[model samples]
Target: MRKIIASLFISLDGVVEAPDQWHFPYFNDEMGAAVDATLGRTDTLLLGRKTYDGFAGAWPEREAAGGEDAGFAKKLGDARKVVVSGQDLSFTWRNSERLEGGLVDGVAALKREPGGDIAMSGSVSVVRELLAHGLLDELHLMVHPIALCKGMRLFEEGEATMPLRLLSSTTFRTGVLHLVYALAESAGDATYDDAKVHLPQDEA
Candidate 1:
């Protein structure tokens, strides 16, 4: 099964909304490379309606003078896109699809298909639902060195406790931290034979 990987840009205070307001200052060569690496791993882009609108509006008309930005825009334009929305609006991007059915069921079915790993970015709401449904496979966060202190946080209050295991951590030259994590094995979901729980017959 293909994995659903989510990459989020969050502040020190956990604010993920409106990254444009505070994300550019922390971006550097290392961070750009990290983004490239992520794009190389996936051909499908999963986005919420808001994020999709933002990206679709910008990436198509963006022009760069021979840099990673140009390349990234091109890659984003070429990648297959699926938006989480109730409206079946006409998508201007190529190879775009809509998830009008229930969100969890639609995304789960997409994961079951044989394809490149699905990647999501800037879709906080969709990512939240994915986590709540236990459908997200991997999470990569670029933690910037600032605090919005009032925007939408990635881990909002009243959400279930999600346990994750740290896979790797890398700090960029610009003080941006790239951290990757996967779901940890929950105690209840952990497989252990009850018969093997007995103490061994050894000298004590």
Candidate 2:
């Protein structure tokens, strides 16, 4: 089964909101390389409605001369997009689908499909839901040097204890630390037999 992975670009304090205070300040060679590398590995994408709109509006207009990242944005625009939202809105992007069945169910279905790894980008709400449901297999977080006192978070409020193992970490020239983590197996409840649990692989 393919793993469900989430790639989030966060601040040092875990803020995942609009990093670029203005429209064009966040683009740099390091960021471009990072974005390019991440996009090349994955073909499927999951996004929140707001983020979907954000990319839909910006990437299509970005010219190739903007930078390597703009070229990457064009590549992202060509990939298949699945947007999870309950609000009724029109999507004009090619090869895009609206996930109206709710985040948890939609993701579960996506996990069952036979395809390349699914990457979640800039969708904290969807990411939080997947984390809460124990549906995520890996998390790739790029923690930037800056910290925003107030912004959206990468995780949600909940009581479920999530154990993670750091698979790898790397620091870029721009001071962004890329941390990769896998959800650790449950240490409690020795009686939990995974085979007899009767959960679908996708649901698991």
Candidate 3:
């Protein structure tokens, strides 16, 4: 089964919206390599409508312009993109297709297909939905050290609690934390009392 990996550039306050407004100041070679590694494993791009629209508008143009980012742009343009939207869309970008049915069913079907891992970026809603439905296999977060204070967060109030187990963590020179997580098989039964034995003698 192909894994559905969701990558996001998030702020210290858990904001995942509009990273373009606050993400670049911390960009470094370490972060670049981390992102490159994620892209290296991705064969298909699963995108929400908003993210798809942004990419479809900019990437094709960037690919044609032929600049430093053009290579990455071309790579994005070449990938098979599946856009999730309730409304019908006319995709002009090559190798783009609309998700056929409900988000859960469509995505579950995609996971069963034989291919390399499916990757998603900047699709906050899609990521939340996938994670909520147990369809997301791994979540890779590049957590910048700044707090946006006001924006959509990966987890919001009234949302169901999700327990994730850390698979790996890397701290970049820029202070951005690259965290990889997978859903926990169980929300462990440990409580505060279970940690009492480890308390410092003075504190106890």
Which RMSD does model 1 reach against the true structure?
A: 5.8
* Number of the predicted model whose TM-score against the real structure is largest: 3
Q: Cα lDDT for residue 62, model 1?
A: 70
- After superposition, which runs of candidate 3 have C-alpha atoms over 4 Å from their true positions? 202-204
Pairs of residues clashing in candidate 3: none
lDDT digits (tens) for residues 7-82 of candidate 1:
9898998999888888998888898788878764579989989899998888777734455467678888888899
Worst 10 residues of 3 by lDDT: 34-43
- lDDT for predicted candidate 1 compared with the true structure: 0.85
Listed per candidate, the RMSD to the true structure in angstroms reads 5.8, 9.8, 1.8
Task: State model 3's lDDT.
Answer: 0.90
Can you give the TM-score per candidate against the true fold? 0.86, 0.78, 0.95
lDDT of 3 by residue, 2-94 (tens): 999888999999999889889999998898778777764467999999999998989899889999888888778888999999998998999
- Which one is best on lDDT? 3
Q: Which stretches of candidate 1 lie over 4 Å from their true place?
A: 63-68, 187-204
Query: Which clashing pairs does model 1 show?
Result: none
Ranking by lDDT: 3, 1, 2
